[model samples]
Target chain A: QKEVEQDPGPLSVPEGAIVSLNCTYSNSAFQYFMWYRQYSRKGPELLMYTYSSGNKEDGRFTAQVDKSSKYISLFIRDSQPSDSATYLCAMSGVGTNAGKSTFGDGTTLTVKP
Target chain B: DVKVTQSSRYLVKRTGEKVFLECVQDMDHENMFWYRQDPGLGLRLIYFSYDVKMKEKGDIPEGYSVSREKKERFSLILESASTNQTSMYLCASSYGGYEQFFGPGTRLTVL
Candidate 1:
């Protein structure tokens, strides 16, 4: 089984809509979960970061992790046109050499204006 | 903000030719990594370095090699590039615990 799995969604939403993206992992050893946003022809940038489980919020974005269910989620409030991009879920265990991260395929999101 | 710059934004090479991809970071990070992104495969790590002159192979390192001669620069070398080696390559760097910062990927096509 893949360590992490996410919906490869070409999810579309209105400009002012709230967007929800999710990821599930099979490995319980994963302690770090991160969300990255990638624009076309650009690099991935960190959006939300959380260690272990629970939730972390930053501005209009909120990231939630449920270790018991091995699931994680990212919610975007009042999504804007600038938020259109591919959202990737990545995770790794906490320890030395934790630089190696396992990535999900990414969900392509488009917010219409 | 930390900046990770890749040498090339795009490259086209003939099969069997030697290819070199370079990455540099201005953040003075202790770890650097090379990963490839395919259509459906997402990103798979090829190699990484934790400290200067110290390297380790990642999940997919069959047709690639890496060099970390300096703390700020890491190089990925394809000694004999093949068509299958064509893909979007990403370079990233980070401290031990935080999320990594990725470079603008290099899209390579080996014909």
Candidate 2:
């Protein structure tokens, strides 16, 4: 089984709606969680980052990590057309080699205006 | 701001050709990584370097090799390009945490 699992969603929603993207992992050793946003024909960019099990908020995005359940989520409030992109979740274990992360398949979101 | 730049934004190569994809970062980051993005497969790490002259294989390192002769530059080499190697290749650099800065990907088409 893949260490990280995410729903490959081409989810479409109207503008101003709330969007939630999630991912699950089987590796309990994972301690650092991250969310990345990628546009068409572009490389993924770091959106939000959190360590261990907790929640971090940045602008209109919120990232939540539950270590016990091995689940992580990104919530977007008031979604806009500009927010239409693929969201990927990644995690890495604690140690010297923690820079290497396992990534999810990614969920593609389209917010229509 | 940290910036990562790739040698090419798009490349087309024939099978059996020796292919080289280069990446350079402005930030003096210690960690550099190479990854390939494919449909439904997400980003798969090909190789990574922790320091100059050091290299490590990632999960899917077959058919690929990496060179890190300099701290700011990393290169990925495909000994013999194959049709199956066609995909979007991405390069990233990090200072030592989960946050990674990525460059514009290089879309490679191997025919």
Candidate 3:
């Protein structure tokens, strides 16, 4: 099985809808979880990051990790057209050097007017 | 603000041509990485460097090589560009944490 798994979603939501993005992993060594937002042809911007589970919130976005189940989530509240983009989840072990990051095949989001 | 800058926002090159994609980070990050974003492939790492003159191969390092002569600069070289190698190239820097700052990306097209 691939180390990380995420549904490639072209999820469409109306304005003000709350969007949820998720990823599951099989690697027990993973300790760092991150969500990155990519606009069209631009590179990804780090949105939220968390270590050792629980949840972290920043503005309209919230990131959650469940180490027990190896599941991670990103929640976007009050979605807007500006939120239309691809969201990628990446993870790695805590002490490993920055090497190959297991990345989810991003979920595409399109917020409608 | 910490910035990761890629040399080109877009480029078009013929197949078999040599290409150089440059990346420079303002922050003195210990780790630098190169990844390519494709529609279904997501972001696949091309190469990475932990320190100056130190490098490692990522998942997809077949046709790509990297250089880190200076602490602030990381360069990805496509010795002979191929049409199949065309994609959005991204440069990222991190300080051994979950948070990574990324360059704007270079979109390359091989004709």
Cα-based lDDT for every prediction:
0.94, 0.94, 0.91
Q: Give the alpha carbon lDDT tens digit for every residue of A1-113 in model 2.
A: 99999988989999999999999999988889999999998888989889888899999999999888888999999999999999999998878888888899999999999
lDDT of 3 at B23: 99
Q: Which structure is stronger by TM-score: 2 or 3?
A: 2
Determine which window of 10 residues in candidate 1 chain B has minimal summed lDDT: B93-102
DockQ of each: 0.81, 0.85, 0.62
Candidate 1: regions farther than 4 A off: none
Measured against the true structure, the TM-scores of the candidates, in listed sequence, are: 0.97, 0.98, 0.95
Q: CA shift at A38, candidate 3, in angstroms?
A: 1.3
The runs of at least 3 residues in candidate 3 whose Cα sits more than 4 Å from the true structure, single-residue gaps closed, are A98-100
> What TM-score does chain A reach in every model?
0.97, 0.97, 0.95
lDDT of 1 by residue, A1-113 (tens): 78899988989999999999999999878988999999999999998889988999999999999999999999999999999999999999878858778999999999999
For residue A14, give model 2's deviation from the true position in Å. 0.5
DockQ of 2: 0.85
